[model samples]
Target: MSLIHALVAQGSTIMAEHQAGKRDFSQATQTILSKIPPNNSKLTYVWEQYLFHYISEGGFTYLVMADDSAGRRMPFTFLGELQRKFIASPTASSSTTSLAPHALQSTFGPVISQLMYTYNTSPPTDDLARAQSELAQVKDIMVQNVEQILSRGERIELLVDKTDTMASQATAFRRGARTVRRQMWWKNKRVLALGIIVALVIVWIIMAQFCGAALRCGSN
Candidate 1:
């Protein structure tokens, strides 16, 4: 079995989540609520490789979905660690209401990320027999989704270049717009005024002639 997703949520609202596998589990997260246990429990479908394990406390729930081979106890162990962190940290604990994803991430993301790093790197020391040994087997078969995971210095440089190019283009666009507005004002001011005056004069003369013709017709 291969691990898939780590999630923190309350009721239907998601707090934070991380994915490890290549498969798109977005639908799973969206639909998994119907099957969510009211308390601490594991949801396992016989046909599905991924299992959902969740624990509810203080109106918050920590959930983790992993390969069925990941075993029930291991995910809970990870979830337990998450629970402790969530309680101890000011991030979610500080919020009196439903935790916002951004706030949760800003405060709890680093810890959750570190937890993922540790679990991915090595099994928890507490459950060596049940967790680490089995996890190692899954790790051997699981291929890293480098696209979603890896960020070297080169990627950061590329991002900086892209941001710079976009900024330059934006500056150039503003400059061009200002130049066009200024040129339109300076170049066309006198010509525009003259054209408007000429058009008005012509209209006035036409109207006067029409009135004169009407008066002549009536008098004759």
Candidate 2:
């Protein structure tokens, strides 16, 4: 059971989905679907002997259940191909917000099943698969522990708070620097003005003394 199940959903709502192999994966699938973040993300979850890999983008999630031996690259590559097919399908035209549970089962379910089989039977050396695998590698999908995923929201909030505090501190620093610059500029301007006034006064006194306030020295 290398590729056991695959699902395409909008948030927690199942749009189109399919499963292969003898194992009943509904319970595990539901749990994973419900917990997947709505934001754009790529992550892998380990549950027992199986691995759940998913990509969430544009409010839609493409997820796969595979045997632990399947490795990361192939499962992600399958998801990449699945996404391309889903986008080209007519069902993709429907509004995501209005989609109900299993809304696209009749239209897109077979597509998922066919894809699951292809990846399960074929090797990953094909050109398309190789290209897709490289794309997944570039994404650097996160491998998440169950405990870590549960606590991620809290950690993100804490990080946001720290960022806000740093931004405010930076703003305050810039304002203080500007205020100091303005004060120094005014201080220098005042000193220059005072020096000019004093120089003018000294020059007037010298002229008065030398020229005799009322009459010129040369005339006397």
State which candidate has the highest lDDT: 2
> Each model's C-alpha lDDT?
0.63, 0.79
Model 2 agreement with the true structure over 109-159: per-residue lDDT tens digits: 999998888888884578456866576557558775443222423221111
Model 1 accuracy (lDDT, Cα)? 0.63
Native-referenced Cα lDDT, model 2: 0.79
What local lDDT does model 1 show for residue 111? 72
- How many Å off is the CA of 104 in candidate 2? 0.4
Q: How many residue pairs clash in each candidate?
A: 0, 0
Name the regions of candidate 1 deviating beyond 4 angstroms: 37-47, 127-220
Cand. 1 TM to true fold? 0.51
Please give the RMSD to the true structure for each candidate, in Å.
Answer: 15.8, 7.3
lDDT of 2 at 107: 89
